[model samples]
Target: MAEAFKFELVSPERLLVSEEVAQVVVPGSEGQFTMLKGHAPFMTTMRPGVIEVTGQSGTVSRIFVRGGFADASPAGLTVLAEMAVPVQDLKAEQIAREIKNAEEDVADAGSDETKRVAQEKLDQLREVQAALGAPAAH
Candidate 1:
């Protein structure tokens, strides 16, 4: 059996998840990475994407997280997300609206640095849209 470890997913609105899980896949800024019990400790910033949690009982739950940092330590893994929502609760229209907003942000950015940052966010949102199988945001 896979070792269980504490995993917590928190959003500004509420504590979304607090439980022991077999594994968790986080959408990091560099790329997605998985965490398991006794994994080496590290921290990373998150991109806008889905977090996959595998429970000890083999059940899987997915949550969408945008903007956050993940902390992995000897104790456990904790994700402090700016926004978090159950994947099942998300609507395609909602994602599409967000993608549109992101595109606008990219366009309205005043400076090169700001535009780069906004473009990154827009790209991340588009990736999430594709992952959710939503129609392309025009």
Candidate 2:
């Protein structure tokens, strides 16, 4: 059997997952990474994407996470997510609306920094839309 490592996924609303998993794939800011038992210690800011967790029972769980912090160690992996939901529960239209709001934010920014941040958000939202099999944002 594969070694089990502690994995926790948290959102402001609730503790969504607390389990021992064989491995977990996380969406880091730089790119996606997989954590397994005895992974080296590290920390990173995550981006909006799917987190795939493979459990000891051989079941896989897919969760969507929207930006946050992730910590890894030999002992466990923890994710403090800004927002999280089961991937199967996400709505494509809802993500599209967020993309529209991000577009407005870019337009309404009062400074270059704000516009840059909004544009990054728009980019992430577009990725989510793509994951949902939705058409590209106009």
Candidate 3:
């Protein structure tokens, strides 16, 4: 039998997932990282990307997270994401629309600071869209 560890994914609105998984891959700010049973303890910031988990049943699932942090230890892994959704629930069209809107806002902003902020938001959206298998906006 494969070793399993507790995996919990949470968002502000609700707890999206909680279960024992054989392995989990998280999008760390430094880079992509994976966790398995009896892994070393560490903490790191998460980036906008897909979180993939493989369960003991040999089933694989994916979750889209905007940003967050992860805590890992010998016991398990806990991911506190600011926003997360099941990959199936993500709509590519909606994401594309958001990217367009953000781009327009960046262009229309009157001040440099505002434009910079909008551009940052647009970048985040693009990253999320990319993780969903959608082409990134130019």
| lDDT top scorer | 1
RMSD of each: 1.0, 1.6, 3.4
Per residue, candidate 2 scores C-alpha lDDT tens digits across 1-138 of 669999999999999999899999999989999999999999999988889999999899999887899999877999999999898888877677778888999999999999998899789878877877877756
If both were scored by TM-score, which would come out higher, candidate 2 or candidate 3? 2
lDDT-based ranking, best first? 1, 2, 3
How many clashing residue pairs, candidate 3? 0
Instruction: Tell me, by TM-score, which candidate is best.
Output: 1
Using Cα atoms with residue i matched to residue i, what is each candidate's TM-score against the true structure?
A: 0.95, 0.90, 0.78
Q: Which tens-of-lDDT digit does each residue in 6-104 have in candidate 3?
A: 999989999888999999999897889989999899999986778999999989999888779999988799999988888898787767777898899
Model 2 RMSD vs true structure = 1.6
lDDT of candidate model 3 versus the reference? 0.86
Point out the higher-scoring one by TM-score: 1 or 3. 1
Q: What is candidate 2's TM-score against the reference?
A: 0.90
Local distance difference test scores for all models = 0.92, 0.89, 0.86
Model 2, residue pairs in steric clash: none
Error of 1 at 62 (Å): 0.8
Candidate 3, residue 22: how far the Cα is off, in Å = 0.2
